[model samples]
Target: MPTPAPSASTPPPAPPATGAAPPGLPPGPPRTPPAPPSRARRLAAPVATLAGVAAAFAYVGTVDPNEPGHYPVCPLLRFTGILCPGCGGLRSAHAFARGDLVTALGCNALAVAGYAVFAVVMAVWLVRAVRGTPSRVTVRPVWWWVLGAVLALFTIVRNLPVGSALAP
Candidate 1:
């Protein structure tokens, strides 16, 4: 005797009921939208951002902003007797370009830290760019407040006679 083939008459399974909402609230908009980004735009934005950063670094590296008259004076330094955290940033970058790490740090340790952070971020950005991945950067409000407090403290300490070492 020969075996028979199975029938193809099986019915499709029913989908679970997911349309109902909680009783207390009215129906609301969808939590997420259906539309998705195009591949070209997704790749273009990261590439543009990376290129912009490279251009900025290149400009800074080429132009000797440390020169007395090369760059415009800071408005804060012009009007106020106090120095801002960014006052020596240009000089610091210049020192960095010249491979003088100590002078760069002395000019603006905060700027040096920022440079290092930016370099690391750019490295990750380039990797993501090549891998065709999306990038997202988010900082908590508490972190922003903490950063502000730290800058304020740095500003105060740099001005004190005892903290002259912190000054540029």
Candidate 2:
């Protein structure tokens, strides 16, 4: 049997229209996008980090690391009588604060290199932060292993008589 047609009392569905609300529906409120951060707000984090680092450096600069009692000896060096990669990091920082690059390198060349890398990275971070696009330093596992290996080699060589200059 054929199906029956709709009754005359019923209304047909309206056709959809472009850029218009559907029939019987109320229009919603207009959207307002969120505002971007201000320049000072964008720079706050980087500035705080730099301030903390500067404070630490100032403390290290005032302290005399060359004095025997001023800083604790590296536990690894004390126990094994061998130089570790960080054996003279404090001295390096102290010398670096005093503007003695030669002494800082003599203390811990790797640490000095690390400081330079940190400075460059921080500079980039600050620039990006000011532009409201902060970034991160992402070292892959392989690079992390390479860094560890380099530090290990530095430690081993520094302990050897031939690499005495590397010792601190």
Candidate 3:
């Protein structure tokens, strides 16, 4: 039997071609690109980080860590009679802020290295922030393990009688 044609009152349906865009959408890219941040927004993170670092250094520079009660003793040093990796970090920062590199290294060589690393990283971050680019620091697992091992070795050596110079 022959099928009846659709009445004129009914509209024709859209074709189901795979390449065709969905109804009401433009034919090119589907999404609008996000707007970039304002200049102040881009600079905020780096500036805040630098300000916090400066405040910390200022506090450390003013405080005398060599005095017995200025800062709390390292828990590992006080309780376990062992020097931890961060045993003299405050003293290191204090000496570093005072421009005494030798004393800073003597207080904590690792902490001095950390200060250098922080400086380099923050410089990069500031540049990127000014340019409105995203930046990150990524340390792989193996490097993290190596860092831990190095800290452990430092702690052990600093606690020994022969390495008394390394102790703060």
What's the distance in Å from true for residue 138, model 1? 1.1
After superposition, candidate 1 runs with Cα above 4 Å error: 1-43
- The window of 10 residues in a row where model 3 has the poorest summed lDDT is 25-34
What does candidate 1's lDDT look like per residue over 96-155, in tens digits?
877889999998898999889888887787677666677787889999998899888888
Cα lDDT tens digits, model 3, 8-62, are 9988875555555778975543455679998899889888989999999999999
Q: Candidate 2 lDDT, tens digit per residue, 1-168? A: 996686898787664545446578875554456798898988888888889989988999999888889788888878988888898899999999999999999999999999999899889988998778858888899999999999999988998898999988
Per model, state how many residue pairs clash.
0, 0, 0
In candidate 2, which residue pairs clash?
A: none
TM per prediction: 0.68, 0.79, 0.79
lDDT of 2: 0.87
The C-alpha lDDT values of all candidates are 0.78, 0.87, 0.88
